[model samples]
Target chain A: MVRPAMSKEGQRPDPESDADHRAFANAAWSIPSYLLSGMAVYGGLGWLLDRWLGTSALLPIGVVVGLALALYLVYHRYGR
Target chain B: MSARQLLAAEGGNEFQAPGTEIFEWGPLWHGAPSWLTKPTLIVALSVIIVCGFFWAAFSKPKLVPRGVQNVGEVGYLFVRDQLARPLIGKDGDKWMPFLMSTFFFILVMNLMGVVPVMQLPAPSHIAFAIVPAAVVYVLMIFLSIKEQGLVGYFRNMMFPPGLPAWLYVILSPIELLSNIILRPFTHAVRLFANMFAGHLIIAFFATVAYWFLFEKLTPLGASLGLLGFVMTIIMTAFEIFVQALQAFIFTLLAASYIGGALHPDH
Candidate 1:
């Protein structure tokens, strides 16, 4: 494993890497929650729509759309 | 009496796989309140143990540290450098007392699962896990509001910059639910589910070993019993790793939340 260069005093010379690692971890952990919440919110709306319109299709559509939107959100926020 | 005769006397020869009943404990003693179960006792003991250990380690500071203080410094530095500093940025050290206590406390509670007498991890009970997660949740919200003004905090959380105005309509609710509702729920469940499942698995293997080796020790069953015994040992070792990891993750997430609150832009 390639270790990051350390200062003579033995501290990590690059604090940016530390921050980047932390951000990566935070983003990774948050992804699942974002996906689940997205599914719940949209799929739930779709369910209500299906009940009102007497069509059984919107729930799955809603779930898919929610999932896509969630992915897009993650990409927009973290993928950069 | 032979194992066969003992099995015959028991009337039910089938092995009973350990289940949720292993997780449930009736009080420590008769007439004790229903709430005063083993998990609760372990939680109380964890609190005392953590406090006592830290007190012993830090009560009298030595310029050249020795013994307990050396172990204490290692723990302190582990939380400070690995958890607090990396996640929380410059303000990390300020939160050491809270972060360190949370890490060690949860670590101890999780470790109780592998301990001989206290074989239940307190956080395996959802309630124990929830208390700490909820505390962090409430603290996060409070800190967010305090650091960022009330409206600013909600605005920043609900609507991230660089996104087009129209996208906020659909995306904002996801952010709201993820941040406000699901974060703590997942936090608690992650610890609870891991410990609960780990305990159940260990208990299952232990029961298998006991039943096969002693209760009904057929020649074929002896090898299976040995396997169970070996697995029980292996799982216990794995559980210790998992216990420590969960504690680290729990504290890391808590620090991240606090860091986010303190520095919303980050």
Candidate 2:
């Protein structure tokens, strides 16, 4: 990903070289927070559903679904 | 606990763990001047230390770079090379003052924990962390608006290029939530939690040693106290590493946020 991006851009003191490193750092800091916010938002929704429906099933399912969504979101934005 | 039992056997008081009360500082004066809390004092001290150090080091610039100038240059270069330049690129040098002050201010604040009498890191308090994080957050927003127009900024942020049209509704909120909301929250919390927990652990072990050795002494409790003392020694070293790392991470994230704001395309 980085190599292609660098070569694609014309050489200007290799600012592109730094992009990948910066991106890696940005990903490191944001990824966990993304996972957490995803879980909290969707898991809260699931918990509300469990309370309304009078069943304990949806919470775990909601949390799992949220995790998957978050993972997808992360990969789409940064990993690729 | 085991030490407390031994102390009890030796007709001494039980060991007690330190509590949150340790963090609850009392007002320093009659009126207390509203803003004169321990954390606030530490924050002011940190600013002074950072400014004073740089002033001493760089006030009289020598072409040859001797003594304090050498140290100042090293710190300046480290921030510019490692953090600012990599992310901000062409105009990176222009932002050096903000980035340098931020990095050093945070580093000094975090180091206050290890400084003898001043045992608390100002950033351990949420407000201290929030002040810097909020400043960065506001700067990011202001810069984003300045760099990209209001409509354009939101458009660029909420809708990245190349995503399918149908996926916009599903994905845009996540992007908004992660960038606008969670970014600052995590930024503040990361610094606060590390410093808070580090201070708590050190206080805990120090209290243990205090309880076993000075308050309730016994043959068996002495060994326990020795263990606690040793653990305190080890944890202090570990806390220093965490302190510096958290400072670096905080600054790195600040630079990252500024970079994102300045150039949304990336």
Candidate 3:
């Protein structure tokens, strides 16, 4: 395996750290899509339910709940 | 007659801000195909320019780079190091041809918004943006299914490890929709929206400057016209930065998507 060059301090850069950094960026970029999808899915479901049940509040509730769930997903996946 | 002359002739007319109408280009000539509009022509020109540039740069390899080849190498190194290597890992070099072409093609197309004759970025048309993004999306799906079996790809995407099985019922739908549908949608929209908005804003400022300074020149409006003129210059400079940045971001995200598909565990 060809190793990366050493730092001035004579310490080799850890390859895993680079991969971790990339994973971090990827997670950050994907978070918005996840949040939007979460809202769309649950909100659509809630809107359907509201039409069937003749209620108007479920849509807002679904959106808020979906947003919270998406945040939780982000935290669970990326926050260690 | 030129737009300026037409507007100037209409004395005392109100300032008309450039609108979505500015983006609507008819065919280059009467009786021409509707699809043969300015943007389509610019896209074709951009393709030729990108191909011609690389051909000139690399047609004859030099032991030591000089002139266009030097510039080409710099571009290659920037994409490889900044985008491909960082995002796609060790396999980055292998995918250079695809990623490099994507980066340059987009950069050149986005830059057309600033070029004098071709003031329209091709990707602003949405269809241009969609085509490249769709290609990447299809490639991503193909790679994911090929590397990880079709079932494995979906399992890994929808049911990420470390999540409890019961929770998967709710969260899985989000993951599936995001990865399968929203990812490419957002990817294409990001580039299209940026280019569309940037070009519109610059046109708005330029129109303001032209309308006030020439057509409706008055003491009160003169200052505003000066302000518009200054803003036009500033925004054009900023638009150049934004164009390059959007191109970089589009490529970066493409690489990230490919990286995810190729190495799902990451």
Best by TM-score: 3
lDDT of 3 by residue, B106-138 (tens): 999999999987888999999999999999999
Pull out the clashing pairs in model 3.
none
Q: Order of all candidates by TM-score, from best down to worst?
A: 3, 1, 2
Per-residue lDDT tens digits for candidate 2, residues A3-72, read: 2332234223876676776677777877887787677767878999999999998888877877777787
Error of 2 at B251 (Å): 0.5
True contacts kept of 3: 0.48
Supply fnat for every model shown: 0.41, 0.39, 0.48
What tens-digit string does per-residue lDDT give for candidate 1 at B1-266? 22233345557879867667666677878899988888889998999999999899889877667888778877887787788878887668799999999999999999999999788899888999999999999999999999999999999899989988999998999999999999999999999999999998998888789889988899999999999999999999999999999999999999999988987874
Report per-prediction Cα RMSD to one decimal: 4.6, 6.1, 3.5
As for TM-score, the candidate ahead, 1 or 2, is: 1
Which is the better candidate, 2 or 3, if ranked by DockQ?
Answer: 3
TM for every model, in the order presented, reads 0.92, 0.89, 0.94
Model 3: residues with Cα > 4 Å off, grouped in runs: A1-14, B1-12
CAPRI tier for the interface of model 2: acceptable
lDDT of 3 at B207: 83
CAPRI grade, predicted model 3:
acceptable
The TM-score between candidate 2 and the true structure equals 0.89
Worst 10 residues of 3 chain A by lDDT: A1-10
lDDT (10s digit) by residue, model 2, range B96-208: 89999999999999999988878899888888899999999999999999999899898987787777898777667667787889999999999999999999899888878
DockQ-based CAPRI category assigned to the predicted complex of candidate 1: acceptable
Q: Least lDDT summed over 10 consecutive residues: which range in candidate 3 chain B? A: B1-10
